[model samples]
Target: MHLTVLSRSPAIYTTRRLVEAARERGHRPRVVDPLEVELGLGERPALYHRHRRFPRTDVVVPRIGLSVTQYGLAVVNQFELLGVPSINGAKGIAASRNKMRCLQTLARKGVQVPNTVMASDASKLRQLVKHVGGVPVLVKLLSSSDKGGVMICETLESLEAALEAILGLGQNILVQQYLRGQDLRALVVGGRVVAAMRRRARVGRFARSLAQGAKFERAGLAPAQERAALETARIVGLDVCAVDLLDADGAPLVFEVNSSPGIRDAEEVCGVDVAAEVIAWAEARFEAPPRARATAARRVPREA
Candidate 1:
């Protein structure tokens, strides 16, 4: 099999680990920056890598970061349309990437989520916040991307200011009831919750995600919370996902579902062979759909 991995840092731990494992497993693997793939508009969309012809690919593993998704998913989607397998399909990636959309889907799936309201209309801002309820409110950009752009406002003046700042981009802002308590980051792969960590803000931070400077340690969650993580991924149509849960009075609230979930945090804290496991899972999933052209080894199946 031949694999093309789309990631920003081919040298990064997770990328390197997965690439090496692919070679060890006797697959031809190429690491390509998705941005480098040129896209053109036409009757039939197409992609081309500059100065190089791409070999047939069996699957594309995307470690797409928020910075890259704008152009990255185009390439990944090309692979999908061309009948190449993707660890997480384009719709799954896009749905999970947008914070607001992710939560809406989770809620529709009967998953408990933070009381969230979205509004961009200057007239509706106050009404939206009222729906969320409380003096202190959290405002998150639906597309915060990095583990950031989330504002915790403790006063009415600050909350209003935060809402204005977030809405300045001309898109709706997600106003959520701030869940105050412990935080859980659950990494799920192959429809299973592989790891979970409890995080305490480093004295001043509000979110348990490392992006908030929270210190973390491995912790066990109630079976309900664990099930929530797995179900979130399943409902989101993901092969792998990072589901962030907030434990407020032992009830877990799904805050985020990340498709290109970071492996470093999960691996460092949980000691899981995340890269190897992801690669092996891809291999197993590939077998799920039988092939017309079969290769014993060292071959890229002709373009499907």
Candidate 2:
């Protein structure tokens, strides 16, 4: 099988690992920068890269980054038009990128998520804060990656300042209830929890991103936590994803569902070849019979 990985660079940790894993499994693998792909439309849609027609591909694994989401998704959509199946489809990727949409989809499917609210008017900022449980609430851009667009407002003054800066840039934001508990991430592949980790924020910090000097370690998930992670992926229509949740009290409250989750840290901490698991799932999916594939598609719950 010829597997194509949609990534900006082959040197990226996850992308490189996937390429190696595919080769190890006896499949030809190639990395294509989505930005370099030319989409052709006519009687039959086609794609070209480097002034040549794109070669035949059996399946695509998208490692789309937040910075190139729009063009990246377009490239993925073009592959779909050409009758190529992607591990995570365009719709799923799009839904996951939009924080509000991802949470709404999961909540509608009966998954508990942090109380979140979004508004355009700054005049209602205080009300929004109260709605999400009050100050110390989380302020996040609707389309953020990691901790780049996240902020914890401990006071109304800080919240107002953060909102002004973000809204001034014309970016939508979400005000979410803050849960003081363990930050956990579960990597789901093919409806199963492949790996799990707990991210601890650095001293005096609120966001638990590795980029923010957070520490992570391999963690085991309870039955309920595992179920929530798997269900979040299925509801979002992603074949593989990472579900980030807070151990709110004794229950799991999902905060984010990452479509193109970075597997480097998870692999190191959990001692799992996450890239290989992802590739194996894609291979099995691609080789499934038509009836089986149809049934699998039907199993994905629709968003409200």
Candidate 3:
């Protein structure tokens, strides 16, 4: 099978690993920059990179970055229009990128998530804070990523200041009840939990994201935690994702579904060939063809 990876940088660890894994599995793989691709129109819609048109490939795996999400998803949508299936797809990526939408979808599916509230009116900021369980809450901007969007407010005064600062920038915000528990990231690939890890925040930090100097180690998820993680992924419509869960008072709650999760650290800690697993799944999916959407009730977990 001819596999193409949509990435800005082919030399990145994740991209390199995926290319290597595809080769190891006897599949031809190449990296294409979405920004460099041209989208063509008319009866025969086509995508071209440089001066050459995209060739027929079994599947496309988009390792899109948050910075280029809009254009990246546009490219992915073009591939779908040409009947080429993407590993994560455009809809899934869009859904996962919006923090509020992702959490709302999970909540609607009866999946437990952190108590969160989004409000546009500054007058309602206090009410929103109260609704999310008062001060010491989290005020996160929907547009930021890699822990840059999140803020921890310890008092009412601090919360008001944070809200003003965020709203002043013309960004939407979500207030969430702070969870003091384990920050576990469950890597779901091909509808299965391939690897899970716990992120321990550095001193004086609340956000335990990997980018925030968080220490990580391979961790095991409980039955409930595993179920929540997998279900969250399904609801978000991602074939591959990392579900962030906070163990709130012993109950696993969805933090966010990350469509393009960084796999380097997880790969090293879990001793799992995550990239290889992704390629194996893509190979099978290319042959079998994917359903329009995954059934929310069905258990899609496979042996890892």
Candidate 4:
């Protein structure tokens, strides 16, 4: 089968492994920057290639990252319009990107979530904070989060300062009670947590995200943690996701979910083959819609 990876770069761990695995499975794997392609109003979205007609693709695996959400989802949506089967579609990406939507979805499913408030403007900030006990809180962007633009304010005064900075960035933020506990990231592939790890901030670090100088270790899970991760993905409408859970005062609170989750670090830390599991899922999903796939011999020539 011919599989196309709509990603911004080949250097990303998940993108490279999945593409290479597809090749090993006797399938044609092509990686392209979705930004390079323009969607045209036609039966097929014409890809602007250097030479020759672009090879027809079977499936699209979108490795969405901070830099690629704009052109990336547009490209993925075109494929869906053409009736292409993706493990996780553009709608799923959109749903997972919005932090509030995912949190609400999980909460509606009876998943424990940190108390949250969405303020359209700064006017409701003070009232919202009071309802949550006037304690320190965490404010995060609705989309594009990976420890990049999240703030933890330890006091109302600090919260106000943080809120001003966030709103100044021209993006709305979700204010939630900060769950004081260890952070764990559970990677769900094919509706299961294939890999999970406890991330800890090294001395003097704040956020437990690897980007924030956090270290990871294989975390032992209770049956409850396993159940929570799986359910979190289900309610969020994703075949693959990363569920961020925090234990707050002995109760686990679901904090975040990522449709396009990265597992290279978790896989290494947990001694698990999450990439292989992703390959298996793609193999199974692709099998059901064989007619939609390009055959092996339809490979893109290396020098054509």
Candidate 5:
């Protein structure tokens, strides 16, 4: 099978691991920056790489960065038009990339999430924060990734200032109830929770971000949390993703569903062959609908 990985940083661990995994499985793989892939539209939609028409692709693994999400998704859509399947489809990526929309979708699907509220009117910012159970609130931009636009405000004055800064930049924000507890990053592939880890923030830090000196360790998830992660992935239309859960008082609340989650963290902490599993899933997924190939065992059984 011929596979293509859509990514900007091919030298990165995740991209390199995926390339190696695919080659080990006897599949031809190449990593291409999505920004460089050119699209041709008309009666015949097509994609070109470096001025040359791309060859037939059996599967595409999109690791679209937030910076080029729109263009990356357009490239993926072109592949879909050519009948090539992607691990996480373009629609899924779009949905997951928009933090505000993702949270609203999950809540509408009866999934547990942080108490979140978004306000387009800056005048209502205070009320929005209050609606999410008051100050000491968590604020995040709708399209921020990797903790780029996240902050915590402990006082009303701070909250107002934060809102002013965000609104000044012409970005929308979501104010969420500050759920304080351990952070669980659950990696779900093909509708299953493959691995989970507890992300511990650095001393005196409340943000459990992998980029901010947070360390990961293997962790066990309760049955409900496992189910929630799986369901969240399904709802977001992601075949492979990482669902972030906050263990707030023994209850798990979904905070984010990342369509293009890094596999390195899960691999490093859990010792799981994440890249290999992804390649295997892609191989099987190329042959049939993902749902048809998915097994019942991937789901946690419900007790009567």
Candidate 6:
């Protein structure tokens, strides 16, 4: 089988791991930057990369980054239009990219999530904070990734300052209840929790992202936690993703759903062959009959 990985660079840890995994499984793998993919439209939609028509691909695995979301989604959509199945579809990726949208979808699907509110009026900032449980609330850009546009405001003054800085730049933001407890990340693949980790923020910092110097250790998820993580991915319409949950009292409250989750940390901490699992899942779909494959492709939610 031939697998195509949509990524900015083949040097990226996750991309490299996937390439290695595919090759180990006796499959040909190619990494293409979504930005470099040229979409052609006519009687038949097509894609061209590096000035040549893209070759037939058995399956696509998108490692789209937050910075290139729009173009990346377009590239993924083009693949779908051409009947090329992808592990994660364009709608799922788009939904996960927008933090608020992801939370809303999960909550609507009866999954628990942190109390979050979005508004454009700065005059109602205090009310918005109160709605989410008050100061020390989280201020987040609607479409941030890797903890880029997230802020912890411990006071009204700070909340106001953060809001001004974000909204003044014309970016949408969400105010969420800041629940203090265990910070957990679960990597879900094909409706199963394949790896889990507990993350601790660096001393003197509130963010618990590995990129922010956070330390993580292998962790086991409670049945409920595992269920929530699985449900979050399904609700967001992704076959593979990472769900971030914060323990609120004894219950877990999902805070984020990452579509293109980085597997390096989870793989290292959990000692799981996450890349291989991802490849295997894609291979299964690739091996399905044409009718079954189309059915599976349509199972992934389409952008409305």
- Candidate 2: tens digits of C-alpha lDDT, residues 1-304: 7788999899999999999999999998999898888888887676787657776677889999888899999999987776667999999999988888788878888999988899766456678888978866777766565457877665667676776666655566688876533779999998889999987654432332234656688999988899889889889999999998888876999988889988998899989999899999989867857775554333221222
Clashing residue pairs in candidate 5 (N, C-alpha, C atoms within 3 angstroms): none
What is each predicted model's overall lDDT from 0 to 1? 0.74, 0.80, 0.79, 0.70, 0.80, 0.81
TM-score of model number 5: 0.85
Q: TM-scores of the models, in the given order? A: 0.82, 0.87, 0.85, 0.82, 0.85, 0.87
Candidate 3 similarity to native, TM-score: 0.85
Candidate 6 deviant stretches above 4 angstroms: 122-127, 143-147, 154-167, 203-211, 290-304
Which predicted model would earn the best lDDT?
6
lDDT for 257 (candidate 2): 86
In order of listing, the candidates' clash counts read 0, 0, 0, 0, 0, 0
Give per-model CA RMSD: 4.0, 6.1, 6.8, 3.7, 8.0, 4.9
Candidate 3 lDDT tens digits, 129-189 = 8897776666777767546777766566666667566666666778877653377899999
- The per-residue C-alpha lDDT of model 6 at residue 225 equals 92
What digit string (tens of lDDT, one per residue) describes model 5 on residues 172-287?
Answer: 77778764337788999887788999976544324322345668889999998999999999999999999998888878889888888888879988999999999999987778
- Of 3 and 6, the candidate ranking higher by lDDT: 6
lDDT of 6: 0.81
Model 4 lDDT tens row, 101-203: 7788778779998778877665566777776666566667655345566666556566666655655555666777764436777888887777888866443
Query: Model 4, which residues run further than 4 Å from truth?
Result: 43-52, 122-130, 133-136, 143-147, 154-164, 202-210, 289-304
Q: For residues 1-304, what per-residue lDDT tens digits would candidate 6 score against the true structure?
A: 7789999999999999999999999998999999988888887676788767776577999999888889999999988887788999999998888777677778878898888899766456778888888865767766455456777665667666665666555566677886533779999999999999987654432332233556789999998999999888888899999998987876989988889888999889989999999999998768877786665345332323
For candidate 1, write residues 248-280 as lDDT tens digits.
787889887889877887788888878777888
